[model samples]
Target: MTTFVTLTAYGLADGAVLALAALGFVLIYKATAVINFAQGEFLLVGAYTFYSSFVIFGLPVTVSVLNGVAIAVILGVAVERFVLRPLIGRSPISVIMVTIGLSAILTAIMQLIFGTEARAMPPVLPRGSIEILGATLPVQRLLVVVVAAVVLTAFTLFFRYSRHGVAMRAVADDQQAALTMGISVRRVFAMAWALAAVSALIAGVLLADITAVDPHIATFGLLVFPVVILGGLDSVPGTIVGGLTIGLIKMYTFGYLDPGLADVIPYIVLVLILLVRPYGLFGETRIERV
Candidate 1:
């Protein structure tokens, strides 16, 4: 049906953004076993940076976008080096709380600088709609899906084939083993944060293009929690699957039921999935010998 087709397109686009956000979360967790509570703030930062550079300062889109991503990369590395490095041997809870604190701090900084106003991005993509099976989708939304897919594919290749990617993977698997093999665990950790930040930056720009640049952009990061959990905490592919599934569920719920239901549905599904498969669909299970 036309309704189905339309909802599916919208859902895929929405899901792609969530998947991109979740990818960043999963990357950090996968590499460093650190659940970055500040991930959403990174999204906020990237979106705002883009807005400030491109919209306010009248910079070229390409240069502005790169500046936003570059800022995120710097923040990521700074957080790792200054905030998280000292806590390396500390308890996971401490690191988590620190990240949560970091999120609050970042949010405050954004509010102070940009205020609480919602901002619409100027038309960056070609303004139009694409018709598919009698369903029309805005080009911006379509671009979000395409860009996300490409980024995901590129990251997948990087992880599977690249030397540094392999090093990160090795570190993820066993830090001690990776260190024994002369792979610098610290370097991989820094790289993981950098990669995660870059992912967040791209997702931020895409989501901003779809919605707007606002404080609410940070919440997108929070919504990704369910997606990553559904996909698996440390599973890259799982994040993508979870994001798309959640996105469809939300769109369908909004279309068939009430708009209010869309907001609650993902969490409901998250709870149900957790009850069924705690490790997620593709998450690895570690069995310890006593």
Candidate 2:
């Protein structure tokens, strides 16, 4: 029972963060029909930015967080406007390669600026412990779950009623039809990228809290690929379900089996799902005729 409680706590925390990361991936894919291989790099930048502003530069927590988020939003908008907008009608492969290259550039820049060492942030959350099922666990874990739930709920509401959210949803459904209705497709594209960055920024902060501000945080973004793919790349709700499932599987496997297997398991599940449903479990199947 103790082991189960511990594993469940860790799993839920990890899963919540993964859902945030995968949510960004799905937003960009759904809105623009482009895969962002640089998603991890965005998280990398966010973590480093926050560490620098809050710890190294000795800024207030609120300002530091806002600065990090601002940078993320700018990066996303810049990428959409300058790097990707020009390639509007290019092949998907071309866009994919561009993002891959962008990832390399972002990684190199982060390493050059921050170096490869891990930096610890001053603990922002209380380090108190709580009992669950006769097992004592860090209260921080529960707090993270609560934070994730609140953020996810806010996003859900934003999409359902907000004007910009409605525009984005329309664009995702059909760009041409949205344009016909006087929606600015370009603006929608930019907003999607901006929102993606915001989600990545939040995920990076959560990861920095769980782990640390380090290059490995970026690697966590890569792991989210499995979560997004498994849940269905274009499905936002899929992110939540898939993230929790993968998180539990990884944590329990690590506690009970080989540690290395935990990392491998999500990918294995993704492959099995892909074999059975190429468009993903919740992804829409489009029949494009030549």
For candidate 2, the lDDT comes to 0.89
**lDDT by residue (tens digit), candidate 2, 1-290:** 89999999999999999888888888999899999999988888888888889899999888988998898889999999999999999999999999999999999999999899988888766679999889999988888888888888888788889999899999999999999999999999998999899888888888898778899787888878888878888888888888888999999999999899998998888888889886776777889999
Report the Cα lDDT for residue 209, model 1: 86
lDDT of 1 by residue, 1-290 (tens): 88998888889999998898899899899888998999999889988898899999999999998898788888888888999999988999999999999999999999999999998999776679988888887887888888999999999999999999899899989998999999988888888888888998888888888888999999878888889889999999998999999999999999989999899999998898889988899999888999
Error of 2 at 265 (Å): 0.5
Model 1 ranges with Cα > 4 A deviation: none
Model 2, residue 223: C-alpha shift (Å): 1.5
